[model samples]
Target: MTLSALDQLKNLTTVVADSSDLEAIRQFRPLDATTNPSLITAAAAQPENKALIEAAFEQARAENYENGELIERAIDILTVKFGVEILKLIEGRVSTEVDASLSYDTAATVAKAKELLHLYQSYGIAKERVLIKIASTWEGIQAARLLEIEGIHCNLTLLFGLHQAQACADAKVTLISPFVGRILDWYKKAENVSSYPIDKDPGVQSVKQIYNYYKQQGIHTQVMGASFRSIDQVLGLAGCDLLTIAPALLEQLEQDQREVTAALSVTAAQQASVIERPVQDEQSFKAEVEHDLMAAQLLQSGIDGFIKAREQLHALLRQSFGLDEEIKA
Candidate 1:
């Protein structure tokens, strides 16, 4: 019997579901799952998850959290609630993001991460089962460095350039999610092109560069290509350490019975010539990000998008809790 593309690809990479929808995750049965503010907001609005949102609200109410504080607490609990549910379905880790509003504050990001872990612990989930997803800003990477010291793993997200990847590896982060489709989007608009061939794709090339660099330097930081716009983009980085794909593309791969090939390997990386850079400090990291137009713009915009999604979730929670009218009055 011929294997589906998804099954064939799994042999070379760990497949992760990039969603918070319980049914979708159940169907895909990905080895791991990841959730961001946007996914959580969408999931929280579903009728099937009404109970989870209510539970989070009740828990916050019982703790005497009120008004703005209540909404904030509920959002955190709801995020963890989704993670708990996802953990029940997957054997590997679930990435729950830190509040994107705290992306630039290292201390605040660290504190929020610990608070999130504490919430997960209350539900009997181990720290090992969760990867605190943080933006790949210099401060965010520094926050991850602090968390890793305490045995708390992190997934540095919104990554676009090799500088960010290198800084993350230097921090010894457990994983980094380089946004594949987003990079392709930026290039498409700037270069005024509809799309490039899969092999010549800017997004594909970016991940290949980062993956090869890590392998050549013997870096242990795992690269999980994320935000894929299509199955071809997903397949373009075959043999990546991991790939957190959205359900739609996962479904596409599941239905196709195409042959899959490993496009990346450590053996090839060892033979490729790679340049090493000096470790980046706060000043240099900031300078490099500002210098790279794509990375700088995308990083800020990614944080802004996540922050907007979180705010939307807060608005939904307020209306659900009958505080929307009160806030207006």
Candidate 2:
């Protein structure tokens, strides 16, 4: 009896579902789950989740929040609402991202993360079961550094380069989501090529570099490869600490009965020659990110994209609550 590729991959890595759709999460049964603004927006727009959205709005309204504050509170509640449901199905942690608008503001980011944790606790969820996801800006990393001391776990996201990953490790972040497909997308457009061989894929190489470096440096921060475009990319990083794959790809892996191999190992990383870089200060961190065009562009665009998604969610909430209708009247 041959095992499915997903089952074999699970033996080598912790598989996490990257979606807010409860049915999909239930079906795939990923060990953990993650949600971002885009994912939440899409989930909130679905008719099946209408009650979740309305319930969050009512809760926010019951608290006497009005207008912008009401919508803002609802969005936070809605994000955690999805997370709480996701946690019920998965045994591991559920990553609930902070508002991307705070990506550049460390103080705001820290405050929002704490607020989200408090909301989770309101639903009887343990702090240990939640990872506050934040963008990987210099300020965001500093914010995670502060949160980690307070025992709030964080997942630094939108990471595209070594400097961002190094800074995250320095901060002792609980995890870092280095994007796989997004990196590949950037290179394909920049280099004017359609695709690279799976072995030579820039995205796969980026994750391999980060994973090996962390293993070599004895860093305890977990690496979760995210945003995969194909199952081949997922297979390429078989022994990653974790991989947050989309539901479509997860379904594909569940159906395929191919043999999977561990492409990374601690033993191999320990033997590899990796350079050690000093922890970055704010100035150096900014300079290094600026020096790398891909990282700089993608980091900003990812933030903007998330911010847009957040706004879209907010709009959906306002319409659902009839706030838009009241204003028109």
Candidate 3:
């Protein structure tokens, strides 16, 4: 009997469930979990989660919040509520994102991350058990750096380029989640090509590029490939520090018993040519992003998408409390 592809991955990588679906995480039994407003919105629509939704709203009202404040507090509590459930089922930390609208506000991002930490603590969960996820914008990276100094770990997400990855390494943050599928999606749409050769797949190459660069530089900011669209993409980066995968793909791996091989080698990365660039700061980071069309577009779009999703979640919460009409008026 050959080992399943996922089994092979688990041997070399720390598998994380990239979803807010508790059942998916429980069934897959991944070591860690990650959630974002987009994922949470998807989960919020499910009938099974109605009780949790109501509970979050009730908690906010009990705190004497009114109108907009009630909605905002419920959003925070709802995120933490999901985190609490996820933490109960997994021993590893859960990555809960700060509001994406704050992506470019250093102080605001930092404050939001702190509020999330405080909320987790209020739930009796230690700060160490949570990774406050922030975007990898220039401001986001700097915010993570500040949080790191205060002993808070961060996962810099929505990453689309090596420049940001390099900056993240310089920041000495806990991890970087480079988006694999999104990059490929961009290239495919731009190039009008249906497919590329397996090994030449752009998304797979992106993660490998970041991973190799990290290893060659001896940077400890772990490279975790995220937003994968296919199993081949997952197998292509089998030896990443971590891979946060959707449960649908996890199910595909679970049902298949094919052999999986180690696709990345840190030793190889160390032996690979080093990519040299100046250390990044706010100004240089902005300039570099402007120069790279893909990174700039993706960063803005990612933030916009998350912000929209967060708003949707809030609207859902308001509707749940029968305040949607009142708020509209």
Candidate 4:
């Protein structure tokens, strides 16, 4: 039997596990790993991961002299704890996100990112071992740009459009995670499409466009395709710079024997070079993205989902803490 399609893809792109579960990460053995607050919050709620979360919280409570301080300390401790565990699993960097609440505030985004970096450092992990994940807002991009100069590599997340990719490349950031699956999800719900065409899939097209643009313009920033819906979407982006796939999809690819070809080629990207366009500024970026209906709608929708997930996590935390309060009383 020949190697599976997923096996072959590892040759063309760096495979990242888009998960927070330590054991799942261990299972996939992705080259890198990424996690957002929503994934982390979900992981923390799991019975198996509860011990891990509690250990961080207990560490926070021990260090804090007051309840207010305890809560703040707990968040930091938990974030670092997850990063540390993830670092042990993957050979490459682990992406730890900044607070989604500060996505629009450049200064606050920078501050929170630095704080996350410091927390990871306290665990004996070097700054290079971590990728600070931030929302791809204009403000967040600026924060990442500043951090990159200071040697903090960032993973620009929630990236739905080319405008975000161009801005990040211009900033000389480390990497951009363009969401192929999430992009498909939005279109699926809106258009009632059951499946996507390989060459024409919205998610695949988005990443291919961004990848070619970066290569053509000599942008050094790496593009990682993320949020995939199916194996076809993954195989469609076989030659992407990287792809962060969920464990389930990885397993599906491993089990299925299918033809995999280089859908994206350097030759194709070089062909796009002849018509290279300059990266956009703020006003033009907003305008250009607004012109693309999919990018505009999906970007707005993704931000909404992030905000909602954050709220749900907060409510869950409050309930957990309230239970703890009763236990303490």
Q: RMSD to the native, candidate 2? A: 1.7
lDDT per prediction?
0.94, 0.94, 0.90, 0.82
Candidate 1: how many backbone clashes? 0
Clashing pairs in 2: none
Model 1 misplaced stretches (Cα beyond 4 Å): 325-329
lDDT of 2 by residue, 1-329 (tens): 88999999999999999999899999999999999999999999899998898899899989998888889998999999999999999999999999999999999999999999999999999999999999999999999999999999999999998899999999999999999999999999999999999899999999999999999999999999999999999999999999999999999999999899999999988898876788678899999999999999999999999999998887777787667634310
Error of 3 at 83 (Å): 0.7
Q: What is the lDDT of candidate 4?
A: 0.82
Cα lDDT tens digits, model 4, 1-329, are: 79887788888888898888888899888889988877877887888877776787678767753454555556667877888998898899898888777888999989988988888887899998899998888888999999999999999988898788988988899999998887888888889988767787988998999998887877789999999888888988988888999888999988878877787777889886464566478888778778877777777777777666655555555466663442210
Candidate 1 lDDT by residue in tens digits, 240-310: 99999999999999999999999889988778887578878889989999999999999999999999999
Which digits, one per residue and each the tens of the lDDT, describe model 3 over residues 153-267?
9999999989999889888999999998998889899899988775998888888999998888788888889998888888888989999999999999887777887889898
